[model samples]
Target: MGLTVMMFTALGLCWGSNFIYMKLAADFTSPAQMTLLRVCCGFVPLVLVAWWRGALKRAQLRLLPHFLVMALLATAFYYFAIAKGTERLPSAVAGVLGGTIALFTTLASLVFLRSQRPSTAMLWGVLLGFAGVVVLIAPWQDGAAPLDKQGVFWMLGAAALFGGSYVYVCRFLAPHGLPALALVTWQMGLALVLLLLVTDTSGMGELLVHPRALAGVTFGLGFLGTGMAFLLYYALLERLGAVASAAATYLTPAVALVIGWANGEVVGPRELAAAGVILLGIALMQQGRDRSKVR
Candidate 1:
């Protein structure tokens, strides 16, 4: 249990800090290029790790189509949206908004997932979480800097795609008994290919000349955030189980807020209050939940 707790905390820290990495890299590259580079650089480690674990050898080629779709929804669209959104939003705000994926996931389940029904708590959680999102956006706030509507919309779209992808994973992929590493390996591989086609590489020469941007893309976003973070999250999902593993989402906002503050980003009271409300909603979503459903 202690190890589980530690892993869970580590997962939150890793994923939470990913927004900072994205923030660092976004300014240097186009969204498509940034996401492409992230997946491409991260791909090496994931492939090696999957091979080391014999996941590649054990994978079923029959599920390639599903993996392709998962790549589109989860990795391709997910990271692209985040990269574009991070360019326009504060890192902490993006991170807080990212956690709202859970709320979207629960709502999505109630619709497309036939076997799933909304619990009273989940319904309330959804409403409360939406309220928190509205407060976080605070469109009516008269201040020096209002929230970026474009950024908010992009992140919300990312969260929604993320939630829907998870539902597809729960319903389709998990039943196939594919190793998580193997799945991610293929997903990233496919995403890398697609991104390469759509992405402009004209900035590559300039980015190579800038060491900070290069390192941010190769090491910060690639290895630690994308490659290792996926491994850590999957480990937590296995050890803590899905519902409890979600505690990471609750813990991430604090990490993001602190990191963003240290990096000279503004952390206002309104943002903090919104995070608290979102946390409350997440807690309610998990309240007395059974293990029968995928989170």
Candidate 2:
């Protein structure tokens, strides 16, 4: 349990930092290009780890389609939307919006999954969480708040995609008994291929010219954010159940808020209040769960 908690905490910090990295990398390249580079870079290390664990050969080819869908919805389109959104939205705002994955995941499970239904507490949580998201993006606030309608749409879309993918994995993939490392590796590989199919390498030379941007892409997006974070996340999912593992979403906003503030991003009272409400909603959502099985 202690190790699971530690892994969960570390995963939160890692994912929280990912928003800032996306912001940095977006400054240098297109969203599609950034997505392609991230998957390609993350793939190498993750694939190596999968190989070392002797998990790669154990993959069932019948499940390749599922892995491809996971890559598209969870990784490729998800990060592409984030990269584009963060170009207009602040990293902190992006993080808060991203954290709503728990809300969406819960709601999605209730609707699409036969085994998971929402309790009264879960319904209240859903309402509060949505309210918080609205408050966070209140265009009526102040002109100084830096709210972008298009960016909000993009982030919310990404969150929904991620949430749906979460339930999909829990329902379909989890029962298959595949090793998480190999599953993640295969997903990255498929995402790389999917991204390459749409995006070009025209910016490759330009990316090489900017050392700072290159570093952000290499270490921030590739090594820490994608590779290490996913590895930790899969470990937590296996140890703790999906709902419990999703608690990492709560921790990420705090880290992102601090990092964004430290980096000179504007965070007003409304943002803080909205974040608090979101956390409250998440807590309520967790309470509605059957935690005995999770533990």
Candidate 3:
């Protein structure tokens, strides 16, 4: 109803549709090439915003090491790994695995941050989330085509990075009370530089020839998904606080599944059930850690 709520909802859609965009672009570009395009396109708006808000500061250069760490953890590896993962998996299935971010985040918190003690509900959530993943992958079925193993692992790895980035932010970045935009700007900037140097971008330009994939890459995936998404995330962090904002994870996979279905990717009862279980697991994990923030 309210503006923030609307923004929150829109954020989920933007992220969810990213998979569809990737699927559209897959035929034209390699995973690194696609990620390079995304990172480059996404960087423009973020830098502009940081400048407009006066969030960019020269002194922040002192935090270069942290920025690079975040660059790898959040932007570089996160995007590329997910792209690699999605390359082999269906958009809907990849999106579901991406939901594992919450599970890993909770696990990271339990292991890395002693401030929050492990609770019974949290442990159960871990189990439920794992079981959901197993069901989603369906290793038992040998006759029919099972989910791609490599893709699933890549997605899981990306999810782990996603989950770990939150802890990295909580432990290292949050203490400074730096403007979130500034930190992200620096992180993404470095990631862009790193990706440009390493990625072979020769054929990358070919993807832009396709109108749909082009629009999706420049706008859907880049401007909205990367740049604006972080802008929205920081805004939500300010308004909703961390725990509540993180709940957006719940909406993202569902939106991705719906979009995937509409886009003609296979969506059956098994995926739906797995999604429900994963969501429930996330709910339980969050419940266990509620109001238990570090003092």
Candidate 4:
């Protein structure tokens, strides 16, 4: 098959597997520690690529204010929050909830992004996306093995941050015309520093004692999920448009569900159905995205 196809498939696998990786490593590290390690490891490959390409500009320092915020929204907060959620919820469930990023982005765009108005289908997509979340959660049930509330909070918050970061970048950073690789490198670097400042490093080596845990962090969470996934995404964007290339919002959850099932997690039909609904909504939003206007 084509290189883009291979990269797209690999990237999806990496992102989908990330939830289970976090779940695996959750036994050994705090969410903070996990985020710290993921960012630290991921940053290495990114900076190297940026250096090789000479994408890192000295003048980009003028945009440090925006980069710092992007660091929080896109890197630090998003990763930490997902780790926190995955620590509590079943990996598949966390993955399903992740589909809401598109929903949040669509809504956030309508509100904050006047330049890009939503089409009729996009509004319907917002409604259906939320309805799918409700099905996923089923809050009305009286303790019928309902999903963890706190975990849902973290996952949804992460989804919102991930989704809204698009708008944030479009408004604040995209206008700068900095190299995408360079911007990502700086954003991740700042996030690494921010995470390092607040995250305690004690007991982090505990993963070394557990082979599975160490593999989860070193392979699945950091190198593949964080670092290599970013590079693959950039490659996909080169091959396909953003709307066509970005599939993790819905794709990873399916992989996560399959992997979760293989791991003996109880993924019933209800979760599968909810995931279907969310995916449908996301597809519509993507199809309906108003691309005529440039931010």
Candidate with the greatest lDDT versus the true structure: 3
Model 1, poorest ten-residue lDDT window?
A: 286-295
Cα RMSD of all models vs. native, in order, equals 2.3, 2.4, 1.6, 1.8
TM-score of each: 0.92, 0.91, 0.96, 0.96
Put down candidate 4 lDDT per residue, 82-155, tens digits, no spaces. 99999999999998887688788878888888877778777887888788888888888884887889999999
Model 2 lDDT tens row, 1-295: 7877778878888888888888876767888888888888888879887888788874477899899999888989988898888778899998898889888988898899887767878888888998999889886666564588899999899989988997888878999888878778888899999898889778676878888888887778788788888778777877876767778888987888888888799888988988989989989878876552354
Please give the lDDT score at residue 171 for candidate 3.
86
Model 1, range 1-295, lDDT digits (tens) per residue?
7887777777778778878877877767788888888898888888888888888853477888898898888999899998888889999999899889988888888888887877788778888988989988988877568888999999999999988887898888888777787889999989998888888898677787778878877787888778887887778777766666777778777888888888899998988999889989878877724533545
Every candidate's lDDT: 0.83, 0.84, 0.87, 0.86
Residue 278 shift from truth in candidate 3, angstroms: 0.3
lDDT against true structure, model 2 = 0.84
RMSD of 1: 2.3
lDDT of 1 at 143: 59
State the lDDT of candidate 3 residue by residue for 140-250, as single tens digits: 887988888999999999988878888888888888888888988898889999998999877766865788888887789889988888888888988989888988889
Report model 3's TM-score to 2 decimal places.
0.96
